[model samples]
Target: MNPAGSLVESLLPLPVLLPLLGAGAALVLAGRPRVQRWVSVGVLVAVVAISAVLVAGAADRPHVLTVGSWPAPIGITLVADQLSTIMLLTSMTVTLLVLLYAIGQGTSDDETRTPVSIFHPTYLVLAAGVANAFLSGDLFNLYVGFEVLLMASYVLLTLGGTRSRVRAGLTYVVVNVVSSLIFLIGIALVYAAVGTLNLAQISERMAAVDPGTQLAIHLVLLTAFGIKAAVFPLSAWLPDSYPTAAAPVTAVFAGLLTKVGVYSIIRTQTLLFPDDPVAEDILMIAALATMVIGALGAIAQDDVKRVLSFTLVSHIGYMIFGVALATPAGVGAAIFYVVHHITVQATLFCVAGLVERVGGSTSTTRLAGLAAASPLLAVLYFVPAINLGGIPPLSGFIGKLGLVEAGVQDGSVLAWFLVGGAVLTSLLTLYAMAKVWVLAFWRPRDQLPVEHPEDAEFNDLDHEDDPDRRFPVMIGAGRAGSGEESYSGAFLGAARTASDDERVPVALPRGMTVATGTLVAVGLALTLVAGPLYSLTDRAAADLTARTPYVTAVFGQTVDERVTR
Candidate 1:
């Protein structure tokens, strides 16, 4: 191997290995919260640097590592091509930021709520699993990657053992376990049909397989990935499962986990069955459903977290749409969309966490006048919210434009229909975000409606004597009066009596705010570099569609030539 090839190959495993090692070290340092934090942060920072190096090295050709000196088709292999490396770099960057945010919030170190010892290790393990999933070169190894991440996520999700969290975690586990079973079945079927579990080898062998059997295998695998990606009918669990977790946990899960499934779909569809018309059609239909339905669901939501969760589901359809087009332009756009969505979604959730802290709740009815209360927080929320709604001059708009252009170029009936659906979904997303903006940020505290009058009465009684109480106190006092007239009057009276300044800002944790602001800034920065990024993804799509580059790099020769030799 050339010197450059050797160096790139050496780095392939570190994105996975470093995190696992860090997790173990974090476990040993369980009693030392400060040391654990340093170890975790240092490890992710290293992974990010390594992933950046790999992205540069793998731009022209893939770097493949055969585990334990064994050759391809026999031993475990890890491949870092343009697609995987891009994903690794982007995911690690976001993971690092989210970790910082978590540290700032002390979510992982609070013993009374989450066990300080378990949180760091479990989080590192989750990072390893995401890296492993992106790099695995075999179906079984990919399955291992999924299991590793899922297991770690199970721990992370139930960290507090709150009844709501535990219940949500249970639902997450059952859904993922079933998905894993289906994935295993699909892997078994692939190996049974081809006598090898190596992905490159499977791709090579699948060409001669019976068409009916190919269709069956394809459907089974897509079903499993669909569930994982939270595509439409398969996505009900996501909105329910994600919102109940802690903010940092929800942020990371919202950003990375579903993208892994989408990445798998992109990999398999292009490599294994690039010409499968039926599957492509099915994917197109699924993409449209996921988009429209998720947007509508987002519109119905009143909680900030739940609204973000539904939007997460909705935007996933954009990525799927790119993949379903089955063109280099389409797939390239999908890849870009994934990158854009990961950063934006995570940023919004982090902002939601901040909102919860400032407002005392995420409910629209309870949150009001946040624009005046914390202009900084309002800017943080609004920037990403509009970006997510596909506002122009942002990464979100760039990505959606790419997909819409690709759909137009395809010029098929279904493609046109999806184009219309994509536009509609974008508008609906804007509407949902605008609604949140008006109710949660714009409306005055005194003008806010009370959802549960009884709860408001209880709150009023609970904090009657507390002089320094914040917005909730105002709400409760407002609701204690006779009716709307009395309620509004009392609310305004309390606000005036409490302070002459109505805009006295609630103090937010500086560390958490800085971390979230940094992430939001990163999301905005994507627009500046969208051109080079999209170009990279386009080349990646070309290679994926060609398939030869990946397979040849895997075995150090074309699969056919290697077989003949």
Candidate 2:
């Protein structure tokens, strides 16, 4: 083995292992908020660094490690290939910044019944779940990883414990539980059919299965992943649930959660049953419907958060379109788009957090004169907003263009229809963003009817009964918003009463600003590095479609022997 490859292989498990360990440490340090901060943030930073090295080295080949030196097919094997490492790095970077933002929001001292503390440990566990799913070389492990992250998210989602947060959280929990149950069923069916849960071994076994059985298994897996990915007809849960969480929670969830499902879909489609035309056809129709329906829903939304949530669902179609083409270039474009969307979407939500803090509202109808009040805020929102709308020269445009090009190459009528849907979706997204800009930023502050600052009803807030009026609220801080004292669902307690000017002013913590600004910079960084990123994804797609590197790494089988099985 190459020395560099071996080094990466040795570090492959750290991204998952370190976070799991750090979560336990966070539990030990629960009483010390400051120490918990250091422990949690330090673990994430280390995980990102490790994941980055693996992504940087992925072109050489995948790094595979069997835990406890157990045999590959029978043991728990973690594989960090180009796709997995890139995802790991992107997710960790976003999460670390979100954690910093959360610390600024003051979740370190989260008061809950557990006393074991929830925020730091739960957040770290969430990171571990994401990493585990990415590295999992077996189907059952992937299912476990999903449950881990989803459960952690359950706590994060209902932090405030208000009627609204709990209601939304319950909805989230029920939907995910059902989705998970369906996913387990698919796993059982696959295992029973193939007698192995190892993905590489399944690949070998699957090739021998009859076409009817393969199609059945493929649809089962897609159905489970589809609900999680929030594909149309299965995505109604997201728009309602996501907008209810605190800003930092919402930002991370919006950016990272659905993409995990997309990643699973990508793995299954590319590695397990690459040639199923039936699934491809279903993906085609679903992609177009998702794009159109999601965009239309965004246009109908009056609240900034809901609009963004709907857009998030809309753009997922573009990724699915790339996957549906089932070509290397097509999947490559999907990969690139996933990276772009993660950063941009999270940045936009962070900006939304800022908007709520500074403007005292995320409702465009209630917002006014933000551009004048905070030029920096406007700029932050503008960049990602346009990037998301696919304006020229941004990463979004580049990714969409790549997908369209791939669709054209495919030359199928369904691909062409999806291409058209993507274009229309982009135009509608731009319009929806423009509507927000005009209402929230450009209008005079006084032009919008001024309600007394103390009135304190959140138009964008779900407006449920907040039984406990928590104090010490930090609006835009992105933690929890106390009931009857909602500060745009970010800070759980009120800090100090705002004066007339301070109430309207864009005063944010330095840590919060720096973290939000860093993410915006990361989005810009993606634009600057688009070329190299595309090249990397292209190589990843090629390697994935060929399916040689992964099998060789895990099963210790040559390509011909593996294919002949």
Candidate 3:
């Protein structure tokens, strides 16, 4: 068998299917946490391996897996083009790292009520949803994928159900449910108008329709995805919801979910409604508003996670700018940007969690003197932070360069203005990151004046379990202590010590430097592989913009003339 063909067969579906099966197996034998953790790790590793093979072999051919041996348009399908493969591989790697990190930083004693048991199942389900969204051949299937992931997220976001978390979850749930409803309505309209749910069929039909009807459909779908993507007017739900989740959960959501929305927008723009008269104008205005508003929110934030959340919302504008350009280079840059942002943003959020763990809090007002506490942690924090702010020599620099260059060559005055705004946004992002660094890592203790414990007369509460009072991080139970709240517990008759401490903080382990190092290495991999990655992005962009391969592969035949405007 040809390696490329075999590679395609194994690469596309196996990553998702293997995990789905593993989640079921884990649930069936849920009595054992150790077994569940190991099974989840093994499943994720398998996914990573398969993803790597796909990325390596993607140069040979793009793979399309028809799930049930039925033809694509009628049956669900998964397609692994260069861009989708890249995202799939990265998402797997980041999620696995977060899971491993979480394993070490065990849950607090309140695990049962927090939906921690559902973590493995829901995480895999979200992964399946992501793969399905990337691979989906039709509009309705994309909606289904979105629903799978969103519902899973609703559980994950409110995992612990702390007071703040419940509030955040309510907002997240309501906003997303509304978006889902809009998405369904838009899909129904598209299906009724075009008489087909396949993406290519819709595109072909859209071309035959009048500009008014076509734009109406396009804008309707965009509105739904815009909310999902957290774009300007539709983006208010993001900052409040995202910052409240646990570290690993927040990391995965930041890394992958919003990008899925951006991906859908790109696919719809480049494939279904190419070069619409209104796309550039509308997106340009929206991109400007998103960039400015998101940046301002990031700057105003005192909490580390909240700042990062706002930054994530703002950065989606760059993707929108690329898609609006309607050129292969622009879309290619968007693909590159999406991958770059995923790694950098996810890593930064994880590092922020470590900061909150090590320092007493993530609030800039409270955190200080980390340089004295741990320089290694500072390095872990600074590298990705600067990279995310789009500093040169990192992958972010390369990605932003691609987007700006594409804008310059695009020949639209508006494009030039957007390019300028991107530069300004980058600088503003740097300012925001620098504010965090100064407050959290670099400021001198004497300058800020440490709090006087003597004056406060703080007491470590001692109960019967006082001899055993311990906060655990990454399995630091026996004598090792952490300031952060934990989820340690006992079985039916076992002695259990449980209490809530709003004042104490979670501390990162000495070895967590390893987790941070792993993430930094992943970022470096993007820079190291820049040439090959860019080439792959170019090919993917060409394939997407051409739209022929996807159409023929999914629909079995090209759409008829009546379906195309």
Best by TM-score: 2
Q: Give candidate 1's root-mean-square deviation (CA, Å).
A: 6.3
TM-score on alpha carbons, each prediction: 0.92, 0.92, 0.88
Q: Write down the worst ten-residue block by lDDT for model 3.
A: 456-465
Cα lDDT tens digits for candidate 1, 1-565 = 5898899998888999999999999889978878888899999999999999999999889989999979988999999999999999999999999888887764344365466567888989999999999999999999999999999999988776656677889999999999999999999999888899998989999999999999999999999999999997899999999887778888999999999999999999999988899999999999999999999999999888899999999999999999999999999999999999999999999998787656556777667888876889889999999999999999999999999999999999999999999999999999999999998899877775433332342122112343233222110001122332122212221122222224344466666788899998999889999999999999999999999999999987996687799
Q: Can you write out model 3's per-residue Cα lDDT over 1-565, one digit (the tens) per residue?
A: 6767665765677776787798897676566667777788899998888888887766655666677888756776777667677778888888788777666554422344433357777777787788778777778888988998888888877775456667888999999999989899889888878888877667777777777888888898899999999998999999888877777778889999999999899888888888686866898888878887898889999778889999999899988988888889999988988988888888888887677566534667656667656777788888888888888888888888998999999978889888988898888889999998997778754444344433311111111122242211222111223343332321111111223112322244643456667888889889889888888888888888888766765554566532583
Task: Identify the superior model by TM-score, candidate 1 or candidate 3.
Answer: 1
The lDDT of each candidate is 0.86, 0.84, 0.75
Cα lDDT for residue 411, model 3? Answer: 73
User: Candidate 1 — which pairs collide?
Assistant: none
* lDDT score for candidate 1 against the true structure: 0.86
Ranking by lDDT: 1, 2, 3
Q: Please give the ranking of all candidate structures by TM-score, highest first, separated by commas.
A: 2, 1, 3
Off by over 4 Å in 3: 1-3, 108-116, 449-507, 555-565
In terms of lDDT, model 2 sits at 0.84
> Could you tell me the C-alpha RMSD of candidate 3 in Å?
6.2
**Candidate 2 per-residue C-alpha lDDT over 377-402 given as tens digits, one digit per residue, 9 for 90 to 100:** 88989999999999989999999999
* Candidate 1 runs further than 4 Å off: 450-454, 457-504, 563-565
